[model samples]
Target: MPNRRGLPQKWCHQELEVNEMAFSHRGNMTECKWKDKRDVYFLTTKHTASWTEVTVKAKGGPTKEIKPDRTLDYNLSKIGVNSNDQCICIILLIEEKPMKWWKKMFFHLMAHAMVNT
Candidate 1:
């Protein structure tokens, strides 16, 4: 198992095998793997390593997906900020010529202001 520093420990070296679901927790930090994908780790003092089923729109139709509570909460919290970033990127002007750092920063801030308003 990998420790806090992400170094594998000799005492608890696990075999390289794929599991349907895997989970580990150290203090407030938790690492969880739901399916055949890389593990997702997060720090949380309030949430537990619990899984819940949620309905989501898939390519075929609506499907139920089992997701960790913290992952769901994290995604929900970042919806507005993610949308704002997308809007800023879409509206921001692109210059082919080289520009000064201050001009770039000013244009980026202006784009943010426009998106917020």
Candidate 2:
């Protein structure tokens, strides 16, 4: 599936799954695989207590560590395509401010357009 940014919807789902799994496992072991045609990202549960620690391994050297905060909006925006013609998925964590309403609406429209296209 694809989202508005011409990117795979799977990426958004995978991130969400990782977030949920991290919170649920707490201090247990869990493993997840996220992949597209070009690359695969693996999340291996390391340790969890109040929070979870996961190691992210991609198809390259130097494994990247994923902290709980890494699942935040700052990271999710980096997962999608940049073109208007492509589908993209983005997760935004915004404050409950009123001024953001228009921005939200715009994103909603764009997402719909991308999906329908």
Candidate 3:
């Protein structure tokens, strides 16, 4: 048992073992491992995750990069979040009517909520 966060507290102190993957329906926890220069752990609810073969541009040129399917899926899934951030940036760029601080914050919140939904 690690903690309420599912990962061991020592994760910051040391590297998690490589090629280690685990999932728990009871705890709703899932861990996926990947590496480049170092090991990385990705947690998700995805049970159908597996390894994916992809090419990466190495220092020399294109090379193989073995990425977890869950990682790929997670990357794919972040488009909306990225889009939301981009939208917020665009919305913020526009000059607005000079109003109270709270009013500006309220509009940003509403815009964020609208983008999320």
In terms of TM-score, which candidate is strongest? Answer: 1
lDDT of 2 by residue, 1-117 (tens): 233333334555544433332222223553333222232333335523333355667788556454443243335666454443344344223323465778878876767675667
- Score every model by TM-score: 0.67, 0.20, 0.56
Go through the candidates in order and give each one's C-alpha lDDT. Answer: 0.67, 0.43, 0.66
lDDT string for model 1 (1-117, tens) is 335573224324443333244566677766554442554445466777787888989899998877778777889999999999998887664654589999878888999898888
Residue range with the least summed lDDT across 10 consecutive positions in model 2: 17-26
lDDT order of candidates, best first? Answer: 1, 3, 2
Error of 3 at 69 (Å): 0.9
Sort by TM-score, top down from the best: 1, 3, 2
Query: What TM-score, to 2 decimals, does candidate 2 have?
Result: 0.20
lDDT for model 3, on a 0 to 1 scale?
Answer: 0.66
Instruction: Show where candidate 1 strays beyond 4 Å.
Output: 1-20, 24-33, 94-98
- Give model 1 RMSD, 1 decimal: 3.9
